[model samples]
Target chain A: MQAQDLTTEVAGLSVHLLRGGEGDPAVVLHHSTGPIGWVPFHDELAQRFAVHAVDLPGYGRSDRPSWARHPRDLAILLNRALEQLEMDGVTLIGAGFGGFVAAEMAAMTDARLRSLVLVGAAGIQPAEGEILDQMVLKEEFYVQKSFRDEESFRAFYGEDETGELADLWDFSREMTARVTWRPYMFDRRLPHILATVRTPTLLVWGEEDRVIPRSCAELYARALPNAQLEIVPEAGHVAEYEQPETVARLIAEHVGSLA
Target chain B: MFISYFTERPYQDEQGEYINTLDLAKSNADYNPVLGGDLYHRYLDEKVYAEEMGFDGLVLNEHHSMPACMGGVINVEASILARITKRARIVLAGNVLPIWDDPLWLAETLAMIDVISRGRLVCGWVRGTGRESVTHNTPSPYNWERYQEAHDLIMKAWTEPGPFRWEGEHFDYRYVNPWPRPLQQPPPIWIPGSLSKATVKWAAERQFPYLMLATEHEPTKRSFEYYDACAREAGHETGSQHRGYLFKVHVDETEELAEQTARKFLQGPSNPFLEGNQGQVRGFMQNLPGMNSRTEVLPTIETWAPAVARGAQRQHKKILEKKKMAKGKDRDYSGSYEEQIAKYTIIAGTPDQVVEKIRNVLEYLRPGIIAIWDGDGAMSHEDTMRALRLLGEEVIPRVREIGKELDLHSPFEVSPVTNKPVAEAVGVG
Candidate 1:
């Protein structure tokens, strides 16, 4: 299905969301690269549930608001966005840096979110390996670290013929920095907040995810009030693009089992 | 023109191979403190001699876990300079403005320095480079906002009768009072900028003298032009007194020795003090995102002159044309030491030759205050002192005359600060 563009203004800033599919409401939160619009993973989800793939304010097509200084600030904006869009009991699925935003949203008081799914999420300071400092990583080195499926990874960016598009890819990363550059990526308060998460949550990991440490997956699963963990084998940080069928099947199963 | 002597107070020289082999992926550790202890005293001695050399100001700066400077806590260095240097204006070319969780402490420290220095303190509030974000563990995105808010709070603490409650988005203080008010009314605030429109605009709005740090002449003119536009918009007139410039320089009896002395400026004198834009950050950690803004990105692209966007465009076209040549046929950026001298990025030679190079910079840039980085890289303490002595005897005397001929005035000569009452308020600090 061709994704339809939807924009909603909050506080004089417009947020871009790519909406498609017809079923229960779901919001797909993109990684630090932000969304370049409906990848194959989102396409897979659109087959089962209505997915609102976001280019959160400050990322991609969305207006980057300076007032959104902290992770919780982005969460509050997302919550308001959900409310304004009138999508109650929506399933929030976040990936990588977007997973950090999702964690914040899920941890909030009286959150409108029905369930949560974090994919190679970055929020908790892992007790083990360090999260790769994304801002400083060169594109060539990052591509190597990002995917076990290098062929698929190259194909993803290979779509952009113009250097302009490649540079535009960095803007999302810039927005991610604005959102999560400080305290590195994890909010110290997040572990406590995750403990208070009122809804069930899902933590998914790529077996070979090189960007965020695997220990982070274990940390999230242990911290959340009601959460389960899933590791997709032979995949990297962008697990969906890597193992789209496996990742999408897991999400579908989680959504089906959502009480 | 207001002349100051500045140095990064580089650590004891070490083999560059350690840094070259070291993985930036793992990051760098702090320089050995044992070595720092010796270098600190030697640098302090250099500043003490600079005042005696008739420099109008003595400058210092700070960085953390970085090999370039031992000024991790610059206020401490400023305190030392304040006590030792008598006449020269002790300018801290900024306390990395945002890193301070408490600007009140900064207010107190600068206030004390002002009293100690006898009203000779030019507080340069700066938004430090992006590397500071990693080293200091401060937020990178809000660096500008924090710098602005922190400056506002500190200014209030200094000028406004404080003990007043203050609240802002970044900072909140109840009973905002600072004891030992500054010896200079609000102390002269100068801002050193790398290349940011926001900073130029902010500096202009407050009439704060904007100092461009070791930048090319054409870009300095463009930045000053930007500042002038902003100042005019803010309903003020801007001139040389409203701007400042800093550059590395060395002078000896002859051109050969001076040229050799200036080699430290290449690839920078130290490893980590290496400029971020020149392939350093990209080579190491492109993953560390969000420190750069649109303005920060444009400056390197635009070159020394924002107004010369067309010139930059032409330059880029030429570079592209060169790139299209057979792989080995392109321009080699690694020019000879003679080329660097001709570029005027570093001023070196006998006193007369140095003066001529400086005059070219002065005519082109038109900064109100010019800071001489007399020491950089492997420049020894004795050599720095020698440079200072030459400036005192030959360079400064001629520069002052040139300043007169050009109608250039230092900030002190132009903007009248309320230092008298502030001085009187501090009876005997």
Candidate 2:
């Protein structure tokens, strides 16, 4: 199913969005590298739910929120965007930096969210290892490290030698740097704040994820009042991108349980 | 012309074997601070002698987490110069502004230096490289904004009656006052640049002298022309006083000796700043996410500008090309060294020959201040002293005469800040 492009105005700022499929509403907040339009994960989710993929403020075609200096700030803006769209009781699926935003939003207020799914999220600091610093690593290398292996990454991005997508990647990284500098990907207060969140949260992690470590999953599980950790084997950071079918099934199961 | 002596104060001990793969800025497994202490003293001694030799100014700069420039905490050395040197202007060309968490401390320190030196301080500022952001952990994206804000904060602290509050985009302070304001009101503020047109335009608009840091002759000229146009647009009459050039020139009794000693520019610590130095900087580390994106110009490290990005790509490309050429062997890229010499990146000759070359540069750029960047890489103390002596006795006098002939007056002669003569300068101060 092809996604239809939509532009939603949230408090004078234009937010780029993609809508597809049918049934209950599910908002897909993309990673820091920005939105990947209608991927296998989105397509699979779209089979049962109306998938609404959004490019957070300062990413993709969305207007930059100049005052934004942290993921919590973006979380506030995303909350407003969801409120403006009138998206209530929706499954909020966030990946990478977007997951941090998702957690922050949930912590702030979960009135808009029915259930929350965070894949390879970066909010709570991992106790064992680091959330790979994308700032220092080369852009290509950073992209490569996000997948399970070479074949999986290549199957998705395929050499990318033309550098045609470099500007988009750079813009997204700029947004990431603006928001996630100093404390890096994780928020120090997020774990404590998340204890107040009552939303049914499903924390997804790739067993072989090299970006945000698996320990972060345990930390997230411990932080949320109502949360479950699901580890997908034979996948990396963005397991939804690598093993889309499995991730979709897990999400479906979780949502079904919530119903 | 205001002739100043400068150096990167290279550590002079990094082994040649690790030049290709290891980025010395990030790793310090081979660093020895014991020897570093000795080298520091040696560089300080050279600066003192530079003053004794009659150089109008002594230029100093700061770089972090790198052996290429040993002046990581240059204000300490500047303070030392303020005490030891009695004649020369202690030009900090300058402190890396954006990385400083509290610019007030810098304002206070510089004020103390100026008062101590009796108004012989030419306070300059640098935006610094991406490596600075990584090493200092200063946000790279806000590097330029922080630089501007820090500058504004420092300037206000220096000139205005403070105890005022400052709330900026990057910095927020409730109490914004520093004691001991500078003797020269605000000192002679200079903005040195190379490739970034945005910086040149900014400096020109403010009528601050923009010193081109060891850039090629034609590009430097074009930059000055751009500055002139910008100055005109900003309703200011522009000349040499608004322009300066940092050129690498070594003078000796014989041409061969001068060239040989100056050729050591690439022989010391492997520096990414110097061409054909067999040094390698990681592309990602140098071009950290927000380092260049803030600026309007191209983001490479060529032309060695303090501003964001452009020339770095060329340097990285050279390293990669060297990798390709030395695929099976341990050969070096000798072509870049020859190219540097041909391009006058490193000009070295007999006193007369060097003077003639300076005349050519004077005729070409007509910069009021020509800072001689020497005493760097692995050159011996004796060689550096001799070069300084030749520069002070033979080169500077001739250049001063040429300066008058060409009507090239420095910001000291005609202040770029106030457009008034600095009543007392150099030795008088």
Candidate 3:
């Protein structure tokens, strides 16, 4: 399944959207390192639900409005875009830093969101260890540490030279700094507001994840009143990007249960 | 001609080993408190002396996580200089605008300096270099925007009457009423740039004296001309007062002694990290992706592309050309220091010889203001004191004569010191 590029305006800023799949809308919110093209995980989920992979403001080709300076601002902007797109009953899946943004939207909005799936997410600060600040880490090292498959690491490094990929790397880092630099990644008030998110949540984790500790996943599971935890074996922080088939299988089952 | 004193306050100790410039976290092992303490105090003493030497101003700049200078907060030093120096403009060339989360503090602090200095504060705003971006982790693209907003906010806080709310793009303040406001009304604002057309044109448009830092004769002329063209386009003709040049110059009683002292600049010791900065973790961290737009980065790319690419052609000369010293090809100044002096990068000789070199530089660049650096790297404090002695007793006064003959109007001469009121309560002239 091939995904097509799209652009939409929200709050006077241009949003870069890549749409594919069919059926109900499944929004894929990417990590801090902004998503450019569709990944394998999107394709796997596309079989059941239409996927709308968005480049968050200041990430990928999207124009970063000056006012989107906080995580809440990003949440508001994303929700505005979805509302303009007339998307309803959408299954929201967010990965890494995107998870932080996703959790905020889930807390505030009720009518549009059907379910929430957080993968190796970052929102709750864990007791044992905090999420690793990825700004200082080299690109190749980040990809290597985030993946369980050695081939996946090698393939990512092999093709990173193209100019577009380099720009995405920069956008992701800058936007991350804009929203997450001060409080680190997690919103301090999120845990108290978790109960507001009426939709069921599924927390997916990479068993070998090191970027954000597995402790965060357990924290999310404990905090959310209606949530389940599923840790995939031999995967890291980017569990979906590393093991898309396994993550998709869990997400698909979760969607079925929700329906 | 406006003569000023500048230094990076090097942490001169041989015990510490070289570390990577980019990875500042891991690279901080080189610092020794004993050395740092001695250096910071001495820099203050040097500023006091610069004021005593009848120099028009003292230039204090900001840099982070570098062993070469301890000026992480320039205003702290400026505040001290306010109380200490009786005369001489406290020229901050200048505070890095993007790093400060609260520009209100900056407005208040500079106001305090202006009050204490009895209305002698020349504020210079700079975007800072790439090293600063990574060290502070400020977004590169916003360097321009933040600098603009921060500048506007400070100006508003100073000029706009009590308690006006500011809702700028980068900064939002409910109330901006700085107590103990600046004495100089709108203190003389200066900006330093290389070949950056944006900065040069901005300075021209705003009527700020654009100070060119150690750029070669040709590039400096082109930049000056560009500023002139900008001023003309904006409906005013620019003069010598619009241009200022800074040089790393050394003067002693003997030629050999002068060359030895002046040659340290080629070392590019400015990086703080003894190792090269390119492609390193800090380099990537500072440069990130959008920190600088292509247009913003073009001038730098044009300047350093060939030298960085033709690395093989770089000879054993430790000291590279100033043009090659921007960001990419930070060539370590090595080899025949005498040869580099001949390249005219560093003006070194007897007092008479140094005067001739200064005249040549002034003629080629024709700047109304000139800042000189007499210390860095291995150059000792005594060497700096001696260099200053020659500059004050001999170089500065002579330059004044030459400047008069050349009609190089200082910023003071072009726009005479007319008191700009901070508030209506302060009584406007």
Best by DockQ: 2
For each candidate, give the TM-score of chain B.
0.85, 0.89, 0.85
Residue-level lDDT tens digits of model 2 in B68-134: 7888888999999999999899998888898999888989999999999999999888877766777
Per-residue lDDT for A1-259 in model 1, tens only? 7999999987788888999998888899887766767788888888887989988778888888877767778788888889889888788999888899888888875467778899999998988988887655654456557787668678666755554554555566566667677777898888976888878888899998988998899989889968899999988998888888888889889878975
RMSD of 3: 5.3
Better of 1 and 3 by DockQ: 1
Name the docking class for model 2: medium
In angstroms, how far off is B368's CA in candidate 1?
A: 3.2
Docking class of 3: acceptable
Q: Candidate 3: where is the Cα deviation over 4 Å?
A: A5-16, A22-24, A84-86, A138-145, A148-151, B18-23, B26-34, B129-141, B172-175, B195-197, B266-281, B288-290, B297-301, B305-343, B416-429
lDDT of 1: 0.74
lDDT of model 2 at residue B180? 84
> How does each model score on lDDT?
0.74, 0.81, 0.74
* Model 3 complex DockQ against the native: 0.33
Best lDDT among the predictions, by candidate number: 2
Q: Which stretches of candidate 2 lie over 4 Å from their true place?
A: B14-18, B24-26, B293-295, B298-335, B417-429
In terms of lDDT, which candidate is stronger, 2 or 3? 2
